[model samples]
Target: MHVSEHIIDIRYAETDQMGVVYHANYVIWLELGRTKLIEDLGLSYIQMEQDGIVSPVLDLQVTYRKAMRYGEKAIVKTWIEAVNPLRVVYGYEILNEKGELCITASTTNILVKKDTFRPVSFKKLYPDWYEIYVREQKNENIN
Candidate 1:
């Protein structure tokens, strides 16, 4: 799959009193990776929203592995895990500077109408974007 890489410069404010990263910050990093992936594909989430389709996370799964400390650099690797008419799942791994896994996660989202909050199909509303999603999930040999 076409994985997107995003580097995060951990800050003291992102950590707990023990210097370990706060759990909620990992979720922010996931979004940064997702945004990078969309940008890499020459697409804009703003544009998608402008089209009256809003993507909302339906579920989130996170597993914390090794603890990440403040001042350490984090590399978030993300890929398109799956995509269907209503849902898209993005997978992620947050690794420390030494490439040790710190966290792994996935976010499942659905496209919905901004006005009504009714679920919409990206495959139907945004065919071109849907095709790109399909193509992005095809690199099995990379991992």
Candidate 2:
């Protein structure tokens, strides 16, 4: 599978009043991981936008397993879970410095026309990129 790892150093500002990383910060980390994954695959979100295609999140699911505090680092492991003509599902695992999993999540994104905001099939618009995702999804399943 095409897996990408992104490391995030928990900042003081990301912590809550109790000193644990805020719940919402995980969402940002997810985005970071996703961005890294896309870049690792040799694609650019900026290029997608410049081409008048936008991918918006259709669904998000996150499960917090362990608490992480500031001064620690988080390793986000991301990969493609599934991909089709219209949607791509990305999976993630956030692990603490000690390598314990702190969160598990997935996000589904749909591509659309930037101007009209109408849904579009990624396979039709970007067949090469779509094929890469399909290959990754197959590798993920095999693992």
Candidate 3:
């Protein structure tokens, strides 16, 4: 499945009082992973917005596996879990440097008009972007 990896060095600021990575920090990392995935596909979220469309997260699901301590490197592996005309699902795996999964998550996003915040089918608003995602999914057999 067209997976993209982004390395993140855990900073002390991201930890909680107990010194382990906070639960909410994982969500931030997920965003970084998603951004990296888009970049890897030669697409930019900023560019999409510039085209008068904004993709907003409609849902998020996260599972914490193991606690990560400070000063460790984490790798976020992200991919398109599913892509439909109106909805897109992105999956993620956050693993420690040793390849142990620390967290797993997924998010559902839909494109909408920025001003009106009304849902718009990707096929109608961003045909090229939609076609590229379709091609990627078909090539990777990730339907």
Q: What lDDT does candidate 3 reach at residue 82?
A: 75
TM-score on alpha carbons, each prediction? 0.94, 0.94, 0.92
TM-score of 1: 0.94
Give the alpha-carbon lDDT of every model.
0.89, 0.92, 0.88
Candidate 1: give the clashing pairs: 1-139
Candidate numbers, best lDDT first, in rank order: 2, 1, 3
Which candidate has the highest TM-score of all? 2
Model 2 residue 76 lDDT?
98
Report model 3's TM-score to 2 decimal places: 0.92
Most lDDT-accurate candidate: 2
How high is the lDDT of residue 53 in model 2? 88
**Model 2: per-residue Cα lDDT over 90-137, one tens digit each:** 999999989999999999899999999999989999999999899888
Candidate 1: residue 77 lDDT (0-100): 94
Candidate 2 vs. true structure, TM-score:
0.94
